[model samples]
Target: MNSQARLLDKLCANIAPGKLEWIGLRSERRGEVVVIDQAEAVVGLGLVGDHRMKKTPGSARQVTLISSEYIEAICRHTGHSSIDPRLLRRNLMISGMNMNLLRYQRLQIGDVILETNALCHPCSRMDEALGKGGTAAMFGYGGLCAKVIQGGAFSVGDAVIRLPVIDSQERLFP
Candidate 1:
């Protein structure tokens, strides 16, 4: 196999299945986040009721996800006894998986299918929500942004499965 093929195989081998631990959404930017047991992932938009749900043409960030493990790490790094996941402003809080590995991959959360868009970059709001040094604490562990491909309902306990990645060129040309 070629080097590119080997790299792709390695990435596939690292796929980690996890579970959604929490969900939060806000009606407006900087608005209060409301915890929900379930949410509707709308295709081309985002989780229903979320302030950032509106689909922007050519924009890749539709939904955001963060790892519960990263949250704990942030708490320890910032010297906080505990930090609420809702304050992170991410649409979903998942656990038992390495979220970074999901980049450039497709995932299925319950019935909704999502394509990883990019790493979610933390903004100044992190400092406001997580206290001082919050933005710096979340530097690389902020999580990921994804585009909703198939709309469906997903609950807090839904399983997060990393789907196999298929090369589109191979599929189209074969």
Candidate 2:
């Protein structure tokens, strides 16, 4: 293998494992976010009561996750003091891991298992939530979108474990 491929593999393997730091669900699209201590993740759907629980045909964005560090980075870049996890509109806020490395891999949070689908690109709504340059500040730091593969209960403080990646020709970025 080439040096770049080896470096990528090494980086992926060394990502610091993270934990579920917070959970938030919006009952309706663009609704106020409700913080929850625990939630039931349903396979093929998403966290119970979340606005995005209903899967759209041909869509892989069943659940959204953001890194707490990423939030801090956005705040620093945007000159904001701090940005609440809920304001980011992602279902779960995680800490420690580089979520971008989990693409094409399975993640275990408590009893639930989720398959990483793709990067959850920042949307225009960011501008509404974070003001002015929110969308651009979150570029490349939006986090991951995943699909629940195993249904179970998960809660704040649960460890986020990245499972072995499935072998496929479909690279995370190509």
Candidate 3:
């Protein structure tokens, strides 16, 4: 590997694991998000009660995660004092680490394992929920999309640990 790759590998590997601050689910599209203290992650599915589990059935976008850090940034970008996690509509709300650095990784939260696949881009609904420029404000701060790899139970306040793979630095960029 080249020097730059070595540097990136070190940086990515050195991340301080984050914490799962909150968990929520919506039974149906446009449904109200119900905050939960615990949840069971189902392999080839999603959180047991979440409608998205059945929506795509083993899809990579099964879980949506947002960092409190990004939400704060989104608030600044939108000129809002603050935005609620319920308004963000993501399943997991994490804190204390940079989710962007952990993309394309397999993340382990308590006993459940999830493969970080892609960005959870802001949808048009953001415009309605967060006001006019919500979508634009969340463009790059919308958080992450992941698929369940190992099914198990997880809870609020659990640790969000990134399970790194070989050559992660390569995937980190592309």
Candidate 4:
């Protein structure tokens, strides 16, 4: 289980794309979870997760999350204080969600279900965004990324639920 401080400081149980809120835009392989006109646009459309952001060519892994421990440890190691996940350029800043549990889960923007393809990993952009040599630290720690299995208009406050076809994996910190 995650430490008590981790759970206690959580910002929200979950987030829905708002009418004018940024919900992280996702496409086939390429996705950017940064602030875009109040919307987190997961760019790229109609491709599989791997087809999009290939550091080389063949690695199917896309956007992945930096583990809580990894993130916190990096901050401590770097002598930095007060970091916000959202500011790190993630499409959606999440708490209490597990990558395995979300496997096959149907993400929605309105009523459309985005068939998620895979998780996104860190890159040099992370180092540029965070600080010097931050990318390496973000490896395996950056939050997961996904493609739009289904697409439509999504707004904040929309309910996020798993699809029936996918099994909810065991929670990591549970």
Q: Pick the candidate with the highest lDDT.
A: 3
lDDT per model vs. reference: 0.83, 0.83, 0.87, 0.44
Candidate 1 stretches with Cα past 4 Å from truth are 1-8, 55-58, 169-174
lDDT (10s digit) by residue, model 1, range 1-174: 456545755877766689999999989878899999999988888888887876353356888899989898899878888889888888899998887667766789999998886889899998998889999999998999888889999998889998875655221110
Better of 3 and 4 by lDDT: 3
Score candidate 4 by lDDT.
0.44
- Could you list the CA RMSD of all candidates, in the order they appear? 3.4, 2.8, 2.6, 8.7
Q: In candidate 4, which residue ranges exceed 4 Å CA deviation?
A: 1-79, 84-87, 166-174
Q: Ranking under lDDT, best-scoring first?
A: 3, 2, 1, 4
lDDT of 1 at 50: 86
Best by TM-score: 3
Model 3 clashes, total count: 0
Better of 3 and 4 by TM-score: 3
The list of candidate 2 runs beyond 4 A from truth reads 1-10, 55-58, 166-174
- lDDT per residue as tens, model 3, 1-174: 567545655777878789999999999988999999999999989998998998978788899999999999998988889888999999999999887776777789989998887999999999999899899999999999998889999999999887665653335444
Cα error, residue 170 of model 4, in Å, equals: 21
In terms of lDDT, which candidate is stronger, 2 or 4?
2
Q: Candidate 3, residue 131: CA error in Å? A: 0.8
Q: What is the lDDT of residue 112 in candidate 3?
A: 97
Per-model TM-score versus the true fold:
0.89, 0.86, 0.90, 0.50
